[model samples]
Target: MTEPERRLWQIVRAGRLGFKFQRQVVLAPYIADFAARSERLVIEIDGETHGSDSAYDARRTADLEARGYRVLRFTNADVMTNPEGVARTILMALGRDPESPLSPTLSP
Candidate 1:
């Protein structure tokens, strides 16, 4: 995993955000960076190189969505610089309350 991937993994793993997420899951031809199968959500951590591949990403996202999954993409910079905000966004996407007492803030 990339550094940002590792960091975000620590925040989201083990049902931390009220859902189970698996890393590097294969959905037929594509491998998702993180997947909470129960919620049908696929999270992708894109690096700087990804800017050149938006078209491919769009197709991949479409394919994933067609396969019944909602895809969320975050840049390495966003994850590294604002993980807490990213986590909150993910929690919102999962339909969970980010302000709930059970929710965890980003660690120092």
Candidate 2:
């Protein structure tokens, strides 16, 4: 993992979102940045290096999805600048009830 990836890994591992999410789950040599097994959420933090391998990423995502995982991708900038929003987006994508305190409202 690069510097930015390591930073996001720390955030997720801290469990600041009050959810039980794990960081750096290694499925062979490829390690997902963050993962919530119960929700089947796999979070990937993309940096400049990702630009060079779009096809590879697509294939990897497809394989993970085929195994019933919901893969969420975010740029390093997004994670560094607005991590709360990223967390909320993940929660919303997992069908967390908007009315619940844990769910952030969708803006118009």
Candidate 3:
């Protein structure tokens, strides 16, 4: 894994996002950076190398989508500079994120 991948993994591993994430998941032809199998969500951390893989990346994403998986991608800079934002976006994509970061609502 790249440095960015390692960093993001620290945030999402061990059911941190309320879903168990596996690193370097094999989805047949391509390996995903991180995947929550039950949720069918794939998170890809793109590094400098991906600058030349745009077309390939698109095809990969399309194939994953066809197989009913939602793919989220983040650049290395995004992870290194704004990991919180990346985590928040990923949490939102999981479809269970709260609207605000405040404490959970209390029962009446």
Candidate 4:
């Protein structure tokens, strides 16, 4: 894994968001950066190289969406600089209600 991916993993692994996530998972023809299969959500971390590959990324995201998956993308900088924000966003995507209270501690 790249540095950003490895860093993000530390925050999201082990059902930290109240859902399990798999790293480097294969979803048929495409591989996802991280996926919560049961929730049908895929999180992708894009590096600098991806800036030149928007078309390919779009096609990949479309295919995954076609398969009933919702894709969330983050740039490497976003993950490395603000993993907590990313985690919070993922929780929201997983239907975590911000208005409701959660455990003070993040661990599940």
Candidate 5:
């Protein structure tokens, strides 16, 4: 993992801010960031490489979504600078109860 990936892993491993509410997973050989199985959320940390190939990223996102995963993207700067807010965003995304709330903050 790169430095930013390592840092985000640390934050996820901490289990604070309702992180423990879901199981955080790291998918290899295809994805490098984090994913929560219960919520079907995949978090991607974008770096300089992302700027060069947006079409590829869009395809990856589409593929993951096809597999029932809701992809949430964040730049490396966003993760490094404000991980807590990112965590909050993830929580908000996870908080949506499909059986109850129709319009949660971060549905997808």
Candidate 6:
């Protein structure tokens, strides 16, 4: 896992987001960075490589969506700089109440 992925995993694993997420999970042809299968949600952590592969990523995302999975992509910088915001976004994607105390917030 990348450093950003490792950091996000610290918050995502073990149902901490009100959903269980598995890291580096294989969704047939592609390996998702994090996935909550029950919710049909796949999170992809993209680095510099992704900047040059938007077309491929779009096709992959389309395929996953066709298979009933919603894909969310975040840049490594976003994860590193504001992980709490990422968590909040994930919680919202999972249909959780973002206003809940368990929701993550940016640290002072």
Q: Judged by lDDT, which candidate is best?
A: 1
Clashes of each: 0, 0, 0, 0, 0, 0
Better of 1 and 6 by lDDT: 1
lDDT (tens digit, per residue) of candidate 6 on 71-105: 99999998998888888888889998878877644
Give lDDT for model 3. 0.85
* Alpha-carbon RMSD to native, per candidate: 1.2, 4.4, 5.0, 2.0, 6.4, 2.2
* lDDT score for residue 27 of model 3: 99
lDDT values for all models: 0.91, 0.73, 0.85, 0.86, 0.67, 0.88
Candidates 2 and 6 compared by lDDT, better number: 6
In the range 2-82, model 2's lDDT, one tens digit per residue, is 766666665555444445678778755468888888778899888879999999999999989988889999998887777
Better of 4 and 6 by lDDT: 6
> Which candidate, 2 or 3, would have the higher lDDT against the true structure?
3
Model with the higher TM-score, candidate 4 or 5: 4
lDDT of 4 by residue, 1-108 (tens): 999998878877887667889999999888899999999999999999999999999999999999999999999999888777787788789888634577223422
Q: Number of clashing pairs, model 2?
A: 0
Deviation (Å) of 16 in candidate 4: 0.7
Write the residue-wise lDDT of candidate 1 on 9-96 in tens digits.
9888888887899999999899999999999999999999999999999999999999899999999999999998899899999998
| Pairwise TM-score winner, candidates 3 and 4 | 4
TM-score of 1: 0.95
Clashes of 5: 0
Evaluate residue 107 in candidate 3 and report its C-alpha lDDT on the 0 to 100 scale.
16
Q: Which window of 10 residues has the lowest lDDT sum in candidate 3?
A: 99-108
Candidate topping TM-score:
1
Show where candidate 1 strays beyond 4 Å: none
